[model samples]
Structure formats: C-alpha cells, structure tokens
Target: MGPITSDQNAYAYSIYHLILYQKMLNNQFDTLGKLLTVTEKQVTGPIYHGLFSTAILTAHNFLTEFDKYFKADSGAAKEKIVLVKQALKPVIKEIKKWKDLENFRDHVLAHNFRNKHTGYTSVFSDSTFLRYDIPQTVSDLAILIQCIDFIGRAIQRYFQAEYDSVHTLIVQQRSGQSKKSMTVEELEQYLNQLNQEVRPAIQELDNKYGIEVKGGAGETLDHDRR
Candidate 1:
C-alpha cells in the first residue's frame, strides 16, 4: 500500500464511526433486553435507565453518521444511494414518526438544559418535558436494530476494497514485506473468492444467531430475529 489519499481517509473515517456507533447501540439494546427479561427491577431500575439513555444517544449518533453517507453529495454513486434508501425506507419512516423520542433525547439526554418557562429538564419536569415512554422507546429501538444491521452490511459490501487494502497493508507491515496495493480486478476477484469461502461460515453463524438470509447475492441480507 502507498500513502493514503484524502478520499480514502475520509471514507475510512466515516465507516469507522458508523461501525463504532452501531456496535454501541446494539450492545446497549442487547443488555437492556436481558435486563427487562429478568424479574429484578428493584435492583436493575437505575441500571435500566442508564442503559436506555445510552441506547437512545447511540441510536442518534448512528443515524447521524448514516445520513452523512446517504446524502446526495456524499461521494457514493447515485444508484447505490438509491438502493440504500429503498432498503431503509421503513426505518426512515419510523424515524420521522419519533418526534417525542427525538425531543426526549435532545432535552433530557443530550442537553439536559431546562427551558425556564416550560420547565423541561429532568423526568420530573412539567408538561413541556417529554417524559420517556419505555415501551414505545423499546419498540422504536427494536426497529432501529434493523437499520443498524442493514447499514452495517451495506458498509461492508460497499467498502470491501478499502477494508481489504488496509488489512493487506497491515499484514505486509507485520511480516516485514513490501506493501502492495491491489488493482481493481484483483480486488474484485479477491472479494468474490472470499465470499465463496465465507458463505458457509456466515450461514452457520446466522443459524446460531437465528438470522435468516432472505435475499440473493449482492442484495440486502435480511434477518429474522428470534
């Protein structure tokens, strides 16, 4: 590999943050789900609140990062952007419907600043404060998990070449060999071969996790969460 260009750096940065936020959101939700199932709310009340708040913030961060990539001038091909948008159409609609959740996130979790006249700060704040609805919020987060999964797979597919180049350069450096960049055709062949090799493993793991791959190759990988 050679010196990284500005475009590569920018692409790497966006993908890195998107994955980071996605993982955080998933972890928070997973933990919250387990906590909810246990019959120990007395002990887990504070823990649940904290985890839920973090999950909300993480979801916001994930969506914001996703929008950057989904935008018209984000350097992604127009057709790719259209496909991503179509895949995420339901998630986008739900996000638009989450006005109260957004307000709660903005006032209580993100800012924590009171509107003096309306007294909108803490959970105890007056009518203006958007009180948290645990059930509704949980349902929303569950839907957003689909968004997270789709975006994660999209990023992996869209930027496979960049990821492979970085991984190869790291491997070369570790082995004290000269770094070499792959040509476009080489990258495509590598990805095709890699997918063939990983398909069985992917299916096995999907079975373990109760994920169902419903679409053809190069299409959105859908999951039937257990």
Candidate 2:
C-alpha cells in the first residue's frame, strides 16, 4: 500500500476533526439548551455563564475551522467542499431567514464591540444597542444545531467513502482479515462518550421543564445512555 499522500492525509485530518467537532458542537448546543432551565438550580453564576459562553464560542469556532479544509488548494478538497456546499444549500437557506441571530453573531457572539463603549460616554445610546429576545435566541440555537447536524452527516458520508477506500488497501496488505484503524475506533468511542453525556441531561430537561428534544442528534439521544 502506498503511504497516505498529502491529499489523503488532508482528507483524513479533515474527516477526523469534522467528526469530533460536530459531536462536540452538538453536545454543547444541547447543554446550553438544558442550561436554560438548570441555571436556576446552580449555586454559582459562573457555572451558568461559563457553559453558555463556551458553547457560543465553540459553535462559531467549529464552523470557522470546518470551512478551512475546503479552502485548501487540493482538487479533492475542492470537490468535497463543493459537494458539501451543495448538500448544505437548503440548511443555509433556512439559516439565512434568522436575521436577528446573524446580527447577534456579528455584533456580539463573534466579537466584542468595545470601541463604541470606551469610558461609558458612548456616542451611541440604548436605542442603537443590539438586543436579543429569548424566543429568538432559542430559535437561533435550534437552527444552528440543525445546520451543524446536516453538515456533519454530509461530511461523514464523504469521510466514510475515504475510510472504505483506505480500509480496502489496509485489508489487501493484511490478507483476508479486515481490521479497522485504532484511531478511527477511538474517535467513534469519543463520539459515543459525548452522546452519553448529553442523553440523560436532555431527558432530565424534558422531564423537568417540558422542553422537547426536537430533532438533530437529540432524535437518538435516548438510544445509548451507557
């Protein structure tokens, strides 16, 4: 078997991280949604604030990083990204409908507009200040989670193709027996762990606050708790 080339290596790197990030991003989004109800029970304000802030930052960071693999000059990278963008076109359309969320991401989530508030004698007053409504926030998170799930699955399909190709080569060298890569299995285990963490929390939230699980990974949130 020829050693993995630069393009193959890049694809593997992208696939591994894509799986890891999507799972984490899903878990964080679920945690934040549950935090909506749990904040009242927490003893310290930091627990609530920290998780919320981390999830927000992480969602932005993962999407930003996921886009970088597509920016590569490799042909495979270009083709894969094109297909991904096509697959995501519908989700993208739905996301665009939420202008308030976009505004929040632009004005607050992605960056801090400290320049406008220097020394408290701000030129712009409350009228110009950006505000987020609760319903909008919840809706934004829901849309964001769905987008992540859609993109993640599309990438997973691409990655699975790559894995199968490589596994074929590995099996060829190893004779009739087929063995999966340890790294791939480890990543899957990590994903399973993340899923486990979120399952009970989501069920608790549903039981306590009556917040429905909705769609996305939450659909299978009940399947594996161990």
Candidate 3:
C-alpha cells in the first residue's frame, strides 16, 4: 500500500461522512414516505423537518471539508474558505431552493432561538416562541435531494481527476515487485481479518442498540420493537 498524506486522509474522511449521511437521509425518506401513507402530517412532518435540516447541514459540512482540504492551494492551504464561493457559483439555483430551509435551520432547528425575523413576538414579551412552519412536501424533499446529489456529483468530479492522476502513478509503479495483486491465500487472510474485526462490532451494535446487519436484501424486524 502507498503512504496516505494528510490531504488524502481528509478527502477520504469527507467522502465517508458524505456517503454515510446520504444513506441515513435515504433511510429517513423511506420511513417518512411509508408514514405518510398512513398519517401524513401527524407522523411525517416533524421527522421530515428534522432529517431535512440534518441532510442540509451534512451536505454543507461535506462541501466545507472538500474546499478546505481538497481544493486548497497546496502552497497556501492555511487560507480559510478558499475557492468555496467560486466553486458554488454553478449551483446557485439549488442553493436558492434551500433559503427557507436554511431559515428553519438557523431559527428553529440549529439555534432554537431568534434570527432576524423569527423566534420572537417582542424581545421583552413572554410569548417569544415561534412555530416551525416550513412547508416540506414530498416535492420539496425531492428538490433538496437533487441539490445534495448535485453536490455529490461535483465532489465526485473533483475527486475523479485526482484519482486519474493517482491511477497513472500506480500503473507506473505496477512493474515493481511490491505492487502486485494479493494471492488467494493473502486474500483469504484479509477476509478473515476483516470478519474478525467486523463481526464483533456488528454484535456490539446489536447488543447495545437493537440494530442488525442482516446479510441479504430482505429487511428483518426485531420482534421486541414491534
């Protein structure tokens, strides 16, 4: 294996979090869609709002990390927020769709207090709480998903270029004795190592959180939860 630099580590970390959050957001969407079939607003509304805010914040964090570590000037990476606004210029429409959601994030979800025009009737009054009334329909969620997907694609494009360069370097290195594919025995040993590492972690999750990793396409439920 090649030595990983700080920049590569940062990029890997950002990609991991981005994919994990996207999976979580997808699962949330599945649950919300099912719940909406039975009871739309009463069950799905709060969940949608919460997960929507989380998804947006997750995407923002991904972009922040991407710009900070991946797109930074190699000589002057200490520069903060470098090239981020310029990078985002192509996605302005998607960003505009998030304006009200951003407001909800700032006022109700993230801060839980007043923004410029929210969370207060009067500063001195006892009635200072405001309702979370952002209208998040399925269509709205679809738009949000589109924006997140766009960001993911953009990040992928940036990484693909880097990957191509790395691939060329690896190809050049392949003639060396140290850079060959693993033997069958080596692959088996690797699988055994992975199984040893992961099985315990999966069991721990099952024990502590009632979660499971069923090794197939079908979903299984814990009878206790039902």
Candidate 4:
C-alpha cells in the first residue's frame, strides 16, 4: 500500500509503515464514497498516524480561518471542522488502542499463508475468516463514517455562511418582498453561471467523467431561513 508493494516487505520498509496504512485507508474511504450516498462523510487523504496528529490538523484549520468566519461572535460559525474535531476526538482516542491490531491480524494471516498446505474448505477456515475480516471491515467503516461526519459538518458550515452572505445581499437590495427567501432570480443566476461558464470548461468531468458538481444543492438552498 505504501511505496513498498506488499506486506512481506512492510517490516523491511518499516519507516513507511504509516504511509502504507494511510494508503490502504484512503482506498477504503474511496470505496465508501462509491457505496454510500450519505453526505456526512470523512474522506481525508489517508490514514492518520494517530489521533493527536488529527487533532492538531483540525485545530490548525480552525485557527487559520478563525476571524473570517467566527469574527469573535457566538452566532457566527467558525467552521464545521470545529464541531467535527470535537466529535472525533473521543473516537480517535479509542482507535489508538486498536492501532496494532491490524498488524497483528496481518501477521496471523501471513503466518497462515506461509504454512498453507493447499486451499481447502472447512468450517474452521470459514470461522477464522470471520474473526479478522469482521473487525477490519468495522474499522474501515468507522473511519469512513467519521469522514462523513467531517464532510457533512463542513458542508453545513458552508451552507450557513453562504446563506448569510446571500441574505446580506438581499437585505442590501431592500426589495419590497413579502418573503425573506432566495429569489428565483438568484437560482437562475447561480444555475446559469454553473451551467454555462463553469460547465463548458469542466464538461469532461461534469458531463462525461461522471463528476457531480452540484454539491448537494438540496432544497434548503431554496428557502431563506432568516
């Protein structure tokens, strides 16, 4: 999974062990995006070395953009990463306990591979597969679910800020309107920009390569919640 090719060489390239694990982790999350339709997903670039590192990165992102979003106000949002890091801190602490479990399981499987007389069917073999397979899959899913949380929270934050900006624009217009919601003009204007200016250049990804640029612009974008 790392620069090294296989588990057989993992110990030999122990320096890159973390890199290898992260590579495998990224693959697992990529699979999650393909399998699930959920918006709240955690898809970081790779497996992290530990929870401490992750917490640090979260803090970094939060502090870097503090004033722009939070602006020293409680009502304003800093970012959803602020919330998600809080959600993840406890879970990541627990995962640290299981850090070596993956390697231990891999060692067991490698041992089995080395001693393999031949491939055969048996209840014992089937049961052993359940043992490691279940836990490995669970870890992968847990991580992916966390990724979902991270992404979903960030999107919510974006929605809030974007909403605030648009609402401010509407107020500045001071149009005599009964409702305080997005005008159809807003939707048409936004969509026209997306469909024409952006689409033409990104058509390969937008039209052919199967990239969805819509970013879950769901019904909430329609109503002005102010």
Whole-model lDDT per candidate: 0.59, 0.56, 0.52, 0.39
Worst lDDT window (10 residues) for model 3? 216-225
Q: List model 1 lDDT by residue over 1-226, tens digit each.
A: 3545665665555665666666666666666576556555243356655666665676667667777653344555455656766876776566555555555666666655354335554454463433444224444456666567667667667755655666565666789856768999999899778777877777677667666555533322333332
What is the C-alpha lDDT profile of model 2 across 98-121, one tens digit per residue?
444434445554444222333433
Q: Judged by TM-score, which candidate is best?
A: 1
> Which runs of model 2 end up more than 4 angstroms from their true locations?
1-3, 29-48, 71-77, 96-136, 161-226
Model 1: how far residue 125 lies from native, Å: 5.7
Instruction: Find the candidate with the highest lDDT and give its number.
Output: 1
lDDT of 3: 0.52
Q: Tell me each candidate's RMSD, in Å, in order.
A: 17.4, 13.8, 11.6, 20.5
lDDT tens per residue, model 3, 6-98: 665554445444544555556566655664565444644566556556666655554455546444335432242244345655664564544
Candidate 4 positional error at 89, Å: 6.9
Q: How accurate locally is residue 208 in candidate 4, as Cα lDDT from 0 to 100?
A: 57
Q: How many Å off is the CA of 212 in candidate 3? A: 32
lDDT for residue 34 in candidate 2, whole number 0-100: 65
Q: For residue 23, what is the lDDT in candidate 2?
A: 74
Order of candidate numbers by TM-score, starting with the best: 1, 2, 3, 4
The global Cα lDDT (0 to 1) of model 1 is 0.59
Q: In model 2, how large is the Cα lDDT of residue 85?
A: 76
Write the residue-wise lDDT of candidate 4 on 75-151 in tens digits.
22333435644655654454444343334333433353221322533324445433432223334555534543453
Model 2 gets an lDDT of 0.56
